[model samples]
Target: MIERFIELGQGYGDLYEMLEIMKTNQERIHNTFVFVSEKDGKKVASFAVAMKPVGDSKFMPIYICREGIPYNAEKTSQRYDLFKEGIEAANKILITLEVKHSSAYVETTLYYQYLIGLLRLYHYIPNLG
Candidate 1:
């Protein structure tokens, strides 16, 4: 099976689109994830929705809004709140994981690969085929 992260954009206006995709593909939805990291000393998070592999194609698309929301325990940003609301509305559980910031990797692709591996280890996504 092949799993990939399909980045929509940072968690701005693009967040709405990500939520819509999850809602539209609710049946195919496998898991919803929130990757939190510290970048430049600020807490941020990336929201993603993993979809089951398509028939025969074996392509599992994980839609993501890369780290763009400011994270705070005292109060959440509007974007993050919207994401939580969407998950609740869709009847899905939100799984949050603290991970290395994207900047730690030399390339964005490498960052995604690291995330994929972590997901697989946690059984959130399938292992390599």
Candidate 2:
């Protein structure tokens, strides 16, 4: 399968869209993740969801709102709270991982590639089809 990350943008609006995607496609949700990283010394997060490939298809989409939200254990944003509540209602466990900032790579493409490698290694998704 051609597993790919569909960039959804970075903003409150974009975050709302991701939440809608999750709610609308609840059955297709294979897994959900919150990738936390430090950018310029401040903690940030990226929310992503992997949808099961459409019936007998070659494409597997992993939607992501890349590094858009602030991350802090002491507090949470309303946006993140909304996402968490929806995730809980859906009965899916959210996976949060600490990762290297995308800026660390020469290009954004490379950063996603590295993440894909990690996902496959952990068997969150199957090997390339």
Candidate 3:
């Protein structure tokens, strides 16, 4: 299976697009995720939407708005709130994980590979086959 991350740009106006993807493809929706990380000492989050693999294609697309939004437990963000509400309305819970910033890796692909490993280790996604 080829599971890949499709970056949608940082969480900003692009966040709304992510929410729409979930709402429109509710049937194919596998999971909604919030990946929190610190980049250069700045707290940020990445919104993700994991979809079921295509028929006989073995390709699963995990859409994401890479780290951009400020993370604060004290303050609620409309972008994050919209995502949370969408997930709940869809009868789903958002899976959250604290991860290393993508900038830590030399290449973005490496960063994604690392995340893929973590996901498999946590059984968030099926093992590669």
Candidate 4:
């Protein structure tokens, strides 16, 4: 399967769009995730919505709000609260993971590839056919 990350933006205001997407596609939703990383010593989180592949498409989109809220456990914010509530309302748990930042990679694509590998390793996405 081909999985990709669709970056929305840092969670300033675009988060609502991400949440609505999940709400509308609830049946297709498989995982809601928060990726926490320290950039410049500041704790930031990227929210993601992982969906099952569309019929025979093989392209599984992992929509994201890259690096905005603080790590969910350490601090609480209104935006993060909305995300948490959305997940709870969907009856799904949001999975939080600590990861290396994109700055570690020379190219942005590399960063996405790294995340894809991590997802596969965790069995969140299917392996290549």
Best by lDDT: 1
Measured on C-alpha atoms, candidate 1 has an lDDT of 0.91
RMSD of each: 1.0, 1.1, 1.2, 1.3
TM-score for candidate 1, please give it: 0.95
Better of 2 and 3 by lDDT: 2
* Candidate 3, run of 10 with poorest lDDT: 10-19
**True-vs-predicted CA distance for residue 102, candidate 1, Å:** 0.4
lDDT of 3 by residue, 43-121 (tens): 8888888889867879999999998778775796888888899899788888989999998999999999988888889
Candidate 1 lDDT tens digits, 29-112: 899999999988899989999999778888999999899888886898899889999899889899999999999999999999
Candidate 2: give its CA RMSD in angstroms: 1.1
TM-score-wise, the better of 1 and 2 is: 1
- Which pairs of residues clash in candidate 1, taking residues 3 or more apart in a chain or in different chains? none
List where candidate 4 sits over 4 angstroms from the true fold. none
Candidate achieving the largest TM-score: 1
What local distance difference test score does each model get?
0.91, 0.88, 0.85, 0.86
What tens-digit string does per-residue lDDT give for candidate 4 at 1-129? 878889988856689999898888888898988888888888888899999988888889999987767764756888889999989878888888899988889987899899889888998778888
Clashes of 2: 1
lDDT minimum window of 10 residues, candidate 1 = 11-20
